[model samples]
Target: MEWLETRELRYFTAVAEELHFGRAAERLGMAQPPLSRAVQRLERRLGVALLDRGRHGVALTPAGAVLLDEARATLDAAAAAARRTRRAVEPGGRLVLAVKANGAHDLLRALLDAYAREPDAAEVEVVLCGIGEDERMLRDGRADAALLHPLYSSLAGFDSEEVLTEEQVVVLPAGHPLAARTSLTLAEVADVPGLPAARWPLRDGGYPPGPGPEVRDLSQLAQLIALGRTSTVIPASARAWLWTAHSAVPLVDAPSVTTHIAWPPQSRSRPLAALVRTAVGLGRQA
Candidate 1:
């Protein structure tokens, strides 16, 4: 088979995701017939049936499901290549760093300040992202680097250096009995009466099965904790920002959270290297 065009992959991906050619066509800003033909051509070239059309609806065959995943990755890589190429040729290059909002706490401030002191440090632009968003930003070239936690962020495709490792702590209402404890185990906090653990949105923007209130950010979670409606576990450093109405107890058995400065494995930017060095040095000091 000859090389497959990105256009064909994109068309097929949209159709596979939506399972409705008309909707996918509308999304692609093209007519349904052409989009349908494109997908058909792609299927013919691959010599396989991608979609099963019936009176009821459209569905993906086994091969179609596999292609959807690969096609999405390929599209993202192509886009990233284009974006990075443009950024490289700009008059004054800058490095964009993605960090989860309310994450990295005091360490972020220190990293930025220390890097700025470097003689020729490229201007570092910080992009504050939502939960589990730093990885996506890095993958799509929206960010040059990211400060991510190993527990919640995937580092499969990136080279990372550990910046800080700290124990986890459970945040609860100041008035709650558990708040008075010096340290609590995970089991002790799991089923707190009237204070179920807060549920955070997943990458798909859906909350995991839970009875607790759904929270999108730390600010909302903090408010819920203060109101005695919900509780959550977070890195120990986060305690520095808790409201007066909130109290934190270290989780004895909870896993330690490690913050890493991560960048694409193929990154060869000098500025990014210098920034990583600064972060590593600061981590050693701490």
Candidate 2:
């Protein structure tokens, strides 16, 4: 069998995702005819019908569905390799660590400080990201490592060590009646009158079905809580950044969130290993 080109995989993936050759072509910034031909050639090369073109529209065949997944993974890996290669040759390459904004809490600072004390520690560049973004940054080589929460991030493709685990608290407006409580159960927090649980964006950028306002980041959610617009359950450590108008009460039944230091297994460099070791050491001390 002939080796597949990244270009072919890219074209096929676009078509598979859009399910319309014309749309895919537009997305690729090319004409429809060539894009259609490229997909056809790929189908022939693979000896499989990747798409079914019925009168309604294009749909993926069983083989196409499988190929789509494989193609996406292959393309991501290729892109990651290119990025890593470029960064490696640059003078004094630094390690980039991605963390969700306000997600890491205290562990991030402690880890950075501890790692800096190591011999010849590379300069660390920290990238603050939104929910569900750290994993993408790590997978695409935009980051050498990421601090991720298993509840909000996927750890399927990386090697990770749990650095911190803490229970959750319900953050509410300081003036709210519930805010006066010393502690509350999840059920009590969930049905607070006029204060719905804030809806967070899913990986696909859609909010879960809820009556509360959708929030993109911790800052937004914090502001909303202060204004009595919404409430949310978050890791206990997040209370450090709560607004003065906000109150955080321990949620007795809320699940604990575990923060993990994750990195692509194949791209683990010396600096990344040292950073991970430092994080693990901190976890043991906690």
Candidate 3:
């Protein structure tokens, strides 16, 4: 009894209840031989006949039935103890959050608020990751989790949730001819005097800079747009956060941006899990 592990109890209970070694192993996610060995070990330690073997089925003896009941209670108690320890560590634990520019919205803001207010989880670690490198960082465990586009959903070994959905807005140059118009369409900007529909340093595609201008980042793109460079199209939230001093109009006929929280399935960090819990809260809030 002292030397028998809880796993042995679990294995015995599974076989006792199922009355079948193969089915018990399948449920326990282990090979049949290993499960049979565990049951044999348990019976040996207790010095009792636990199961009556049969060609077509297995049945627990009376002693096995009593042991099965006790085993389940012991495992439940063990599980509760584990949860308490996890909660203790959750307080002020570290979390590595990976995010792209697209997911910076009210939902993310709310998630921050939740984490900041959680009782067992208030401390956090945030990382700014780009969409281009999102999958690698998550799959390789370089980052705990990330905010990504819908495309990242295709990446295996990870889970995701749509936390935010913001519509696209038309970012126009200040004092531009089309800026006076209430709204514009994609077809209207297709041949408009700027760069192609999509360009670097200009994610929103609302207002971009010169084609050869070497717009290294959004900061430069915004500066150029302020100086009446090419226009860009950006999500509405980005418009509020980054469209300062720039003329912005909603797209008359463009689709909205769907923001999702993506994370590797294998990570077991408590704080990282808290962030995901916060993401679920955000999803509910959405």
Candidate 4:
């Protein structure tokens, strides 16, 4: 078998994603016949049937499902390579760091300050992302690095350095009965009557099954907690974002959340390395 070229990979990816040659070709700005031929040739070369064409439209075989993931990764890698190459030639290219707007505020500030003092450190641009958007930003080359919490974010394909590890806490309304407690067990906090656990949206834009109010950000969660509509477990450091109406109690049995400076494995930028080193040193001092 011959090595697959980028063009063929792109064509196959479009078809695999759309599962219809006509739609895929339209999206790719090409005619349908050539797109169909290109896919057929790729299958022939790989000696595998990637898709099943039927009257009901098209479906991916097991092999197609596997290849779709691989092809997307390959395209992301190629795009990153192009972006990095261009940035390398440009003078004073800034490093973009993605982070949740309401998380790790102290750690983020210290990391930036320390990195700024380093010799030849690059200017950092902070990209404040929503919950669960950090990994996608890193994978697609939108960011040079990210401050991520492993408990709430996926770290599947990145190289990361642990920055801070802390216990969890439950945030509740100050007027709630549980506010008087200095500390609470996970079971106690989770079973509070009339206070359901706040539901957060998953990466796929769907909320987990729950009766509580759906929250998209820390501000929303804090509001719901203040109104006595729901309660939530979060990293202990997130207490900084709570308002006066909110009270936090350490959850004794809750899992620890580790904050990490994560980046794609394929990133070879020097500025990103300097920032990661600075973050690790700060973590050590904490």
Candidate 5:
């Protein structure tokens, strides 16, 4: 086994993530040749071929795939160490909380208000992230904690407290035939002519193949539903944002969404603990 340097791990991670030396080089603000050389050096030091290069372009070898995950963990730890050190030296530092901008509306409002009243609470800076971004934000030190729903967000690698749980609902245009229904089953909402359920982007940035419109955020989906172009199933709390032109029917068979206050397991920050405590207390009340 050989000792790996942070620089080499960083270089390898960039290439592996982009799967293109040119793009990775541009992202790292360096020349492509040097970036390629760095990756080659890392592979040689590890005594394994990392990337498979051919006419089709770069693909990670089995070793490269393993190294990618390990390298990301290394980089995230380094970033977290730096961030914590800075926060420790600074006075009156604020704790950042990440959440999907459209999700966790009610829970976030209550958590913020309650946390504000805590005598030991530090300033809470909310970071409105895109779907599936909260985990990265929490792991990489960009956020101290996140409000995430387990159904729609990955809660792996973090310690969490369940903050809210609610039934799911099918959101539809007000004039839709099923809008008058008191409750709906998954089968009942699966296929609707001209109102296909909106497809959300997967973690990989691509939408699943479907006839439905691809949507990136809640507002976009809401607009599409308003226009009678799409429908979607979401947590019941989202009903708070529906317009008069929109309607929601309880999805009796849909899985409940449990919103949790999640943070990196390695975190030992006092402000973060206070915020989590506040969220847990409020969750119990709910």
Candidate 6:
């Protein structure tokens, strides 16, 4: 049996992740041909083919799929070990915080305070991930911790904490009579034709990069209702996140949106308690 080194696993993982040799090479800041050769070498060492080359791109083989997970784990453990070593030397290692949606910036700020207050003076790195990206980052160990929506909990190996409960809102056309109602109710709009539930593109990225704008001004969402055809229901936090003029009407007694804090089930915490406390506080203030 051949002994495997960390470097090969790292390279292989990136290639598996990108699924395109060129893209993976670019991500690693290396040239494509060598990256391809390295992957070839790894397959030779392992005595198995890991990828299925393709005209469009590449796909993982059955062995490649198994290897991808193992490769990711190997890289994660190595990274974790390096971080621990640095912290042992300097008593401070950078933490990566992955959050769903940018509005969680307040929580990030609180988390920073908590980390800074730690005796080790740990460094915090915050990543504002799209709605579904948090769990992947945590399990892969790319991020030290994450604040994700509870709905995304099925991501395999992560545990979640219910950190915040938020209210809902009714978004109406700017000129709709309901917009003048001061307060809105879902029951009232249930029969009033179209309510914008948003077909949600089968993929929820939270906010897409270089947005065409999700709500594109609540007034427009209201206008969707104003089409006198459809009404929109959004979380009250949408007020915090997408407030634009008198475009959305707040509702009462609606189901609260739950925000979750997530991490790998077996993950450790540097200043976990403080981080949780600060997260709760940020939610309260919202």
Model 5: CA > 4 A from native: 14-45, 49-61, 88-90
Question: What C-alpha lDDT, on a 0 to 100 scale, does residue 240 get in candidate 4?
Answer: 77
- lDDT string, candidate 1, 1-286, tens digits: 3788999999999999999999999999999999999999999899999999999999999999999999999999999878877887766579899998867679999999999998758888999887898999999988889999978889988899999999999999999999999999999999988999999888776999989999987788889999999999999887777999999999999999999999988878888899999999999999
TM-scores, one per candidate: 0.92, 0.92, 0.58, 0.94, 0.86, 0.55
Find the 10 residues in a row with the least total lDDT in model 2: 84-93
Q: Return the TM-score for candidate 2, rounded to 2 decimals.
A: 0.92
- Predict model 4's lDDT versus the native: 0.87
The reply for model 3, stretches above 4 Å from the true place, is 1-92, 151-156, 194-198, 201-214
Better of 4 and 6 by lDDT: 4
Ten-residue region with minimum lDDT total, candidate 6: 195-204
Residue-by-residue lDDT tens digits, candidate 2, 1-286: 5898999899999999999999999999999999999999988988999999999999999999999999999999989988887876666568889998877568888888999998757889999998888889999988889999989889998999999999988888999999999999988887778998888889877889978898887778888888899998888887778889999899888888999999888864777788899999999999
Clashes per candidate (backbone, < 3 Å):
0, 0, 12, 0, 0, 4
Best by lDDT: 1
Of the two candidates 2 and 3, the one with more favorable TM-score, higher being better, is 2
Q: lDDT per residue, candidate 6, 1-286, as tens digits?
A: 5787888887888888888888899998999999999999999888899999988889999999998887777777677656544543444456677776533444556657755765744566777665456666676556766777654435445666666676667765566667787776667755554443422222434443421224433345544444544555655554544434336777775666677766555545555545655666666666
Scored by TM-score, the top model is 4
Superior candidate under TM-score, 1 versus 4: 4
Tens-digit lDDT track of model 4 for 1-286: 3787889999999999898899999999999999999999989989999999999999999999999998988998888777666766667868889998778778888888999998768988898888788777777777888899877788898899899999988999999988999999988976788999999888778999968888888778878888999999888887778899999999889888899999878667778888899999999999
Candidate with better TM-score, 2 vs 4: 4
| Cα RMSD for candidates in order | 2.0, 2.0, 14.4, 1.7, 3.1, 6.6
How many clashing pairs in candidate 5? 0
